[model samples]
Target chain A: MTNRWTDGPGPRLRDVSEDELLAQIFPLLPRGGPVVVAPGDDTALVRTAYGSVLATTDTMVRGRDWLDEWSSPADVGGKSVAQNVADIASMGGRATALLVTLVADPETPVAWVLDFAAGLGAAAAEIEVPIAGGDLSSAPAGTLMVSITALGDVDGDPVLRSGARGGDVVAVAGTLGRSAAGFVLLQQDRADDDEDLVREHVRPRPPYEQGPVARSAGATAMIDLSDGLVRDAGRVAAASGVRLELSTELLRADLDRLTGVLDDDAALGCVLTGGEEHSLLACFPPEVALPDGWRRIGQVGAGEGVTVDGRPRSGGGWDHFHP
Target chain B: MTNRWTDGPGPRLRDVSEDELLAQIFPLLPRGGPVVVAPGDDTALVRTAYGSVLATTDTMVRGRDWLDEWSSPADVGGKSVAQNVADIASMGGRATALLVTLVADPETPVAWVLDFAAGLGAAAAEIEVPIAGGDLSSAPAGTLMVSITALGDVDGDPVLRSGARGGDVVAVAGTLGRSAAGFVLLQQDRADDDEDLVREHVRPRPPYEQGPVARSAGATAMIDLSDGLVRDAGRVAAASGVRLELSTELLRADLDRLTGVLDDDAALGCVLTGGEEHSLLACFPPEVALPDGWRRIGQVGAGEGVTVDGRPRSGGGWDHFHP
Candidate 1:
């Protein structure tokens, strides 16, 4: 209300109408992958393969999800897509389109929205998916929220958490604890010490292709390592009614990667309980060979819960409300 | 954070973990329309007919979209689904599934969430679409937002806004100014005098089935009247490169219904400039007969913009950022 729109280096959202803002943002988005009808209509029409589509949604709030000082608008945009894309991949599906929603304050700068759109468009383009359509709204002061719902299709059966059996081998397809380590370093004001860890924490690059490949190679169960290895693996254990036996020796590579930036106990903690990693964790039959990027980290056995080196491990991961 | 969870009649979100809250909510949601895989999975799988899916998303925020004093949790839930469902319908597609996202403060009451889910589930049940899956995250204090991404499929080609031609008859399938009139009544503290108007403002019951009906009957171009009739008609006009000539005499019935509660000028204004109305406005070839529920109010001619009785009308509708 105080003419914040005119005082900034660029125009704020309050200075422009919704249509005007959309005109500026639409050109920055990715188009034409399964998109029969693009944005600007009541609804967008996208082609679905195999008659079945996979659906998932994820939301991130400004203060709770990330700090502006730590994450650029582009980082938030790319991370939002990566998290949702990982969900589809975990289910053995390839993403085809995305529907995004941005609810921000009227005082939000126009540059932020355009930069965020660019980041989202780049991420979607990397995966060969289109930004089909989305909604934009203004929220109360100090509130900025973004959400993405990714739609995908699978050629064959989708992998479920309940499908793992006693003789299955557990594996992971990407880096572990890097995001969590990056957060810790940033919190301790050691961000300048390690660029890779900081970058991973802000913008993770999950191995999305490994998901369908694992499914094609007969993956019994799969999940995205969103809430860390311990908590997510426990989910698979409870759903499949079996115990996951992890060996520290098998996780040595992950631990070693973090050890250079953290103490021994801290490194182990990061490897076991880091959240927002977005890696794919899966289980396959013992007779089947592991996929190219997937490394065996554990095994499924007749029991419940997850244990490291035959001992029950504790220290849970992120919880939205309880945290 | 200071014991807000325990002092309430029901537990707050902070009192339970994400999984615990999800356990309570999954039961309150509708399932089994086109759902091949339900909630509790990484992503839900839904069937899409005719190899094409219609995608659209909308978001609502507290203190901007609605106020707790005027709308109950159930009303908000139902309105969210209705708005999204209307978009899909306007595109001449039958909604197959919905993905919802909720971002709330940690102090949000668990009972409020359950009630919201009940309302959403009931609305989806009425339309026979399943609530496939969604995300939940905690936001900063005093923030509550809800969003839904709807996926639908069309039997034939989708009716786009650019398809209208000159000499097409313009019609509407549902109420026009009821929602705007309702909001006006609420703002004037005249709630005790007209329950119907206030109810329409909070919970709109859109004519969902009429979308496909008009399409099957050869509708040329179609759009949802989410914004006021004038604004939405302008969109169709701009996209189709035609002018819409509206006649007030044809809108006499709509004006008459509102004049009982409002003055003649105010009634006409409401009918023409009301927002949040989920009715369908469409164009049809002059040779085609009007559908059962549709009423002719105008005609399409070669030109641009919308005209009322051969005169151009001004006065824009809701603009999220500008408003």
Candidate 2:
């Protein structure tokens, strides 16, 4: 209590009321997206295309999700937006708008809030999705969290995760293992030498536009690689009741890109076990042609869980509590 | 950390992986609303009505927003849904769906999460809005939180707070002072004696249908009383650029209802300064016939701010970081 607001230390959220904080952040919000009625209301009105709209929500908690020393406020905002938007893309829809909620301690710096807003604004601008409306509240001491809810519009019918079957080709439309490599680089204190790899861990760039592209090209099943390629693909495999046969040869391409950044085993592990990549992993009918940015990495088969080069990868990644 | 999920103590989240946790909670979700694609995917596809939809989000942090001793897990879940849904109602829309996120310690009980889900499910069932999609992540030890994003549909144009103008009559369709009085009752251990007041604090039932009723009755402006009557009325006044002249004579009726529960001054203060009531406060042209359950309380004029009994009340209600 004898800190920030009292000028005893750093800047504090308690110095200004929640109303004042929202007003300050209002000017920084982007209005370029499909917002019919902007913020500062009980609820924001947004435009959706068809009768069906896709929705998803995710959260990032400090200490558990990120450390302030390693990540800028902008990085937190961008990562939150990237992960949520990728969920919409995985649904074969366009991310239209987002409603965000930030919970912080009273001692949290105003600069951090503003920087987070900047990242959120930049991400929204990059994807053309508006920050429609959100809530701000204080959390228990020593805790700061950001939660985002993303809304999306589908073209016709949504491509679901349960649609993959035998004889389908598995493909990916974005980079993989970069985030994991970045994590390892950060762990090894090589972030300065490997800026791009570190950036991947701090701020993910998902192939959002490729979602609808895959849908248009008849993607049978799709998912976002938020929980690693093997685990997330296992989700699709379980949901579709089809075995996912992943090829280590096909995955070598991802590892090749990580050659100098990490060792062979680590690169391969990162490609298969890294989470938060936000890459689009999908399955398409064998006859369907793969679109640009999408490369065949595996195939859908008649058996059980995921296998890399005919070997089971039960060595999953990122267990929330246990980790 | 020694609690749930351990063999010697109890059930802990670490006992099951995130996938197992989701599977257990999925059956507890209510799918009564317009859900096209269900959970267990990257995102959920929901059916919308028109080209436009309403969106809002809110968060509740444990020990800061509520006390575990006073509120059950179900109460937290129900209250979270109630407040967010009320935001959509204030915009003159019907809430259609919600996406929820929960962050808790890995040592937290499985029963707590399941009970929270049950409360969320019951609330969704009560309002008929599907629990479309959600995320669960681990938090730092001893910290637990729940955040909700609500989606709503308007018939056509929404009733916004900025639309109130001169010669408009101000009215409300729900009760006030009950929640704040309930808060006091809980603090004093008077909750058992005043069951209704405690229930009011634990579970607020906002008059949702009355929102469209006001809109259909040609209401010009509207706001939800989440920040108390005086503060929220100030918002309407500031947004509409009008003086909101609240009649103490009219508020006497609200205060009168609290006579048996609280003192005169406390009741009046509660009616004027209590937040989280979620009552619909609106303005309609003088000619519009007042709908049932709606009662006139004041008038709008070419002025600024809010006045109670012809005097300015500069005092406001709840500040997130301060109060």
Candidate 3:
């Protein structure tokens, strides 16, 4: 059957029924990973190796979270998955499946949705997680939003941010401030000058495997750096009842990498205050060996809040409601 | 700490930071179920009795799903949770936890958000399920959307829509056509005429416990009636590769309840075609005794579509993209 919606000339969502759209979408989404009952059923069922499940959800809005001028539908899909899965990774678990929900204007093009699903499927496939099921709804014109709920399984105890103790070493896995740098470049219309940073902003590749590795290596507390480092670390400090003492000398490599693309102050600012990094921030016991790809940069101390070189540092990060 | 945003008079979402808003909401939301690590963490961890998890998601938009003039923020929150939990019920599972995501404009009032969370938390607590965690995002002006993902635990095999046989008898748990009747009343500005129907339209009370009851009674197949009766039954018919033979005589009680509100044709239409009822429809062996609270409505036969009194019937339901 030639679908007038999929094969026809630039069909919009309003031109097709919900079932037809779902039929087209089911094939585009990632499948085949611990799925017992998939999307055709009322609820998708997935087998869990562990008795417990790690659950997290994140939403992305069209105009607020990303502009159509800067992000394609595919990039938005990939980025949304990145942020949600990073939450599971930070919990010391591996994502088993995802439930996605998309609310779009009726005028949204069918092609755009397909590209988004394809990109989302590709990203989930890369992590071996299935897009088990989701919901779709039509919205008022010019409104587009996507949300993903990631479910994960952990073999042992799930890591929490409150587990950090005094004398633990603070370490990180993955880059810092690159996404913020990319945001700055996009704002300055200099995105072409730093393609790698710009790409990281659009589609973050969180180190999924390292989560279990860190857990196995006995990390005390872990969190994904969605907000700026100082801000997210402050959350760790508050939750664990300990202060994080940092040294800029240990972060010289991250700062130097951005110096070529930005001024010294801007580079330092991005490294300290940029958001949407999706990097792993974890604390290890002083005697435990740091896993590969982990970089130690700070230590846990008997105090509260974050500090840099013995001086207090204010938490500066993106707050969704704040400007 | 006095929250200038929540305690102050009518503060908008933009007036407070995300953490402040969350702190206000977390206290209002229902907790204490299988939650191991709750909302304060990167991801919430939930314990599941079954090794497999039943996952379903549903989304509701401001203008499309419900009008602010007609439905209160609490109504929206309650309705969203009802729809999601209904899906899990149809799968013969009890919901263990929920992850909610809200995307609203910056101008949205904090009071509205608090009411929404209160309603959601109350609904979840009634079923003994915890609101594990969620995400909040700011949207463009005039946009408000809520999405929920429910995770469930099933004791044994989940009843699928494809398991019905020709000798199965169809039964329905919960009311039919009430929400549609309420919708019509609301559209005609006669909401004051029947407060019960209008309330049902706003906040559906699905028979959540009857789902597991039906499963234990040896139901062959089951589905939630989110769409109209005939339409959702058609889905079961298609999935099971059998025809559902329904009788208007059997549905007379459902029709009679609405006849006072509308004409005979309209009443029958509402009974057969009203959506968002959140009722469960299940098929059982002819010899199996019907569970309490379930009324016999139809029979399964060897065919491919739905039939009303031996005549072929077309599925009629609400399509999100269609008028």
- Where in model 1 is the C-alpha error above 4 Å? A1-50, B1-50
TM-score of chain A of 2: 0.84
TM-score of 2: 0.84
RMSD over all Cα atoms, model 2: 13.0
Q: What is the alpha-carbon lDDT for the whole of candidate 1?
A: 0.78
Candidate 1 per-residue lDDT, tens place, B37-73, comes to 3332112234444244666888888888987878887
lDDT of 3 by residue, B92-178 (tens): 877777767778775665556656776776787677766565666777777788898887766677777878999899999999999
Candidate 3 CAPRI grade: incorrect
Query: Among all windows of ten consecutive residues in candidate 3 chain A, which has the lowest summed lDDT?
Result: A36-45
Please give the distance, in angstroms, between residue B15's alpha carbon in candidate 2 and its true position after superposition.
Answer: 42
DockQ of all candidate complexes: 0.12, 0.12, 0.12
lDDT of 3 by residue, A144-249 (tens): 7899888777666667788899999999999988999999999999989999999989888988778888999999888888878898898889888999998889
Candidate 3 local Cα displacement, residue B133, angstroms = 0.5
RMSD of each: 13.0, 13.0, 13.7
Ranking under lDDT, best-scoring first?
1, 3, 2
Model 2: docking quality category: incorrect
Report clash pairs, candidate 2.
Answer: B4-B10, B4-B11, B4-B12, B5-B10, B5-B11, B5-B12
* CAPRI-style docking class of model 1 based on DockQ: incorrect
